[model samples]
Target chain A: MENNNVEILLIEDNKNDAELAIRAFRKANLNNHLIHLKNGVEALEFLFGTGKFDVRDISKKPKVILLDLKMPKLNGLEVLAQIKANEQTKAIPVVVLTSSKEHPDIKRAYALGANSYIVKPVEFDDFSKVVTDLGFYWLLKNQPHV
Target chain B: MDNKEKTIELIIANKKLAFQNQEKEKRAHELVSANKELAFQKKEKDKRAAELLLANKELAYQNEQKDKRAAELVLANEELAYQNEQKDKRAAELILANEELAYQKELKKKRASELSNSNKEVDDLEKRVKERTEDLESFSYSVSHDLRTPLRAINGYAKMLEEDYGTVLDAEGLRFLGEVRSNANKMGVLIDDLLTFSRLGRKGITKSTVDMNMLLETVLSALNQSMTHNAEIKFSNLLLAVADYNLLQHVLTNLLLNAIKYSSKKEKPMIEIKSEQKNGEIIYSISDNGVGFDMQYGNKLFGVFQRLHDDEEFSGNGVGLAIVKRIIDKHDGNVWAVGKEGQGATFYFSLPDNDK
Candidate 1:
């Protein structure tokens, strides 16, 4: 937890799914200072240094943000728009994870500067592999200007 | 002459007497001749005057008759002139009418040509539609085959896990493996249905006079396994129809199976299979006393994999109605359903008179 520059920030409402994603990240050996926010609202508060994460340094933005579209309040698209709109968080990459490939707003998410899109796999093993691959690609492979 | 005169006197007297007598006789004769000549001239003059008078009267009568005839001729000429004018007017009107008829004929000719052009366009469109339909069938077939291969892999591995490594797996892991198997099986069913639908589109239908009553009976007998409940299936006097027998059988089986499946929840499910002839079309209906669907999803009923009821409530892949629709379409017929939620559903299919 020392020098906590969050490398992977996962914003998901479902606790089981969040736990599973974390497990997959660990299995892929790409887990490095990962933070799981319950929903878009918490993720926004964390990024802007408000609400529960007021003491957090806004300059130390996560390298990658994995967003779930269907959450309780403040959906992924709104969170993505807010993040990309701000100059401080604009460079951070956002990947959208959705349940339905036919979700109407997928194209809109890409238009609003989403880095990637992946359909949530129903099977557990496939889900884990997809999550691992995405973590690895964003965290290690792509050299983003911090 | 004196002596002779005296003697002549006596003689003269006698001669005078003779002379007188002669003179008297000559006078008498002259008188008589003059009278005769005057009388003759007077008579001739009178006859000539009478002849002139008669000729003048005859000429006057002839002149009067000619005047009358002249007046009549003028009147007749005037009548003929008026008749000629009327005839000219009629001829002019007739000419205008003929011109109009000719114009109309030309217009009709142009219209006929335009119709012919449009008919050709329609034919071209129909040809394109047929070609596209063929392409779609082949595509669907290829998709089905391709999709099944992956599904088989998924199913095979899951089965292998269960069969080969069942002892090593925990209870929850085994349950998860079962779900995987079931889902794969569902995918297999979906692929099979898609193949059936594609095949139906490609197959050329041969129609013959089919006994519908007998056909329904046969279909019912085939579906003997579906009749768990003592469902009363009543068939009225159904007339014969001209349709593709095999395809029609498929339609009936689908409907009958749906009836049985949906109505299994009813205390006593009553299915009434009836027929009616209207406007040269035979309508066959199957009504089931069952837990039916809402009317809002009516339009989506015949679409592939469009299910109104949840998988927990009714076990179906939702391709049955779509198959029924395709078959009915091939037979040049229509199919529809009317249902209320928690009530019942009546499925109707009509066959056009093959006499046409």
Candidate 2:
């Protein structure tokens, strides 16, 4: 994995979801610079350049962070709070992608400074379209803070 | 003196000088005897006078005792008369007190009856609200659990099939697959909207002084991001309202989105928002130059799943206006609309101005 140029960080715990999201990105040809972190702990470790990713460059921040709310350890809201709290990672666009739209954490996610929120559609095509569209919007259209 | 003269004449007839002397002696004796008699009579008179004086003293003492007894009787009579007057006054006071007590009892009876009637009304209202809430809760539960899970599976598996067998399938097959996926997606939206409607019924409103201008601006920015429309919305110096911030946001979003969607076909889609104070209520209106509905079906506009236009013309699940109606009703407000067939439409709602 080229850690220096990682553009999209997908923090998802479910194996099927990770695979589906990766496939969707690949279909849209946006998977080349994407990194899939299975849990929040590893996501934090990778972002901070600690633990197993200690040797990688820490300054290379992803253009967008696709976070899932429910996880086994250090759920998305906590991770989001940590991310937004740090000046180094505060500018990164964090999009909360979740299965349930009515999850009580949605408002909390927005309150915690998530840039955008999207409910993961059950249909594969719609999910794929959403991912592709978000990739295009954040990567191709939006101007990142320098 | 005449009796002595007669005795002397009888005695003097006997002898001249001697007889006359004896007669004189006899007359002298008789005079002495008469003097004695006179003295005894005087003594008796003196005793009678003493007895009369004792009788008079006894009568004076009796008169004194009678006068004393008569004074005591007069005092006793005066005391009895005073007690009778006091008793009459006390009886009159008791009569007035009894009348006042009876009046108070009558007032209490009337007040108790009114309270009982109000309690009955409150009990009936509570029962009706509870029944409707229970029905809404059960329906929401079923929609959330039974409906959504299967819809998820359907949509998920359909996508899997399309992904796994896309190369082998022809164009028509892909199109059919697309339809299935879209329909499933539509069903998901419908379920979501239904859940939102049901939740509004159960959710308690958290009130605050909401700045309508700021709230509308935020909603407009959000809508601008979600969809593209060419409607000129107008509002300035909007009034602040005390309401639930999030619920009011939902209300504004629905009305504004509807206005934009219905007026999308117009050459110049115009949406004007204005507010006025009327009869202790703040009335807010959103007017749009849209494809309006007939007044005949106006009563049915806010019903769930009641649509005025076909899906080809304007697409919606028709739960938006119902949610708006419910939110307004929760605020103790009223919602209504005025429109002609193809000219334009105006939606009006009033919230109680309780700040004053």
- lDDT of residue B328 for candidate 1: 93
Q: Could you list the chain B TM-scores for each candidate? A: 0.69, 0.64
lDDT tens digits by residue: candidate 2, B1-356: 69788788756754676767888998999989888888888888888788888888988988998898889888888988998898899899989999999999999998899999999999999999899877767666655545655665667667888878999999999999888888888888888888888788778898999999999999999999989998999999999999999999999999999999999999999999999998999999999999989999999899999999988788888888999999999999999999999989999999999865
TM-score of each: 0.53, 0.55
For model 1, residues B172-277, the per-residue Cα lDDT tens digits are 9999999987897777666677677877877899888888889988998878854555678899678788888888888988999899889998989999988888
Model 2, native contacts kept:
0.28
> How does model 2 score on DockQ?
0.20
* Cα shift from native, residue A123, model 1 (Å): 20
Question: How big is the positional error of residue B27 in model 2, measured in Å on the Cα after superposition?
Answer: 20
Candidate 1 per-residue lDDT over residues A1-120, each given as its tens digit: 632588899998876567667877987886768999989889999999999888888888788999988787798999999999999898999999875443557789999999898866
For model 2, the superposed segments whose C-alpha errors exceed 4 Å read: A1-120, A123-146, B1-142, B157-171
Model 1 spans with C-alpha error above 4 angstroms? A1-146, B1-116, B198-204, B209-213, B225-239, B276-281, B295-300, B303-306, B329-333, B352-356
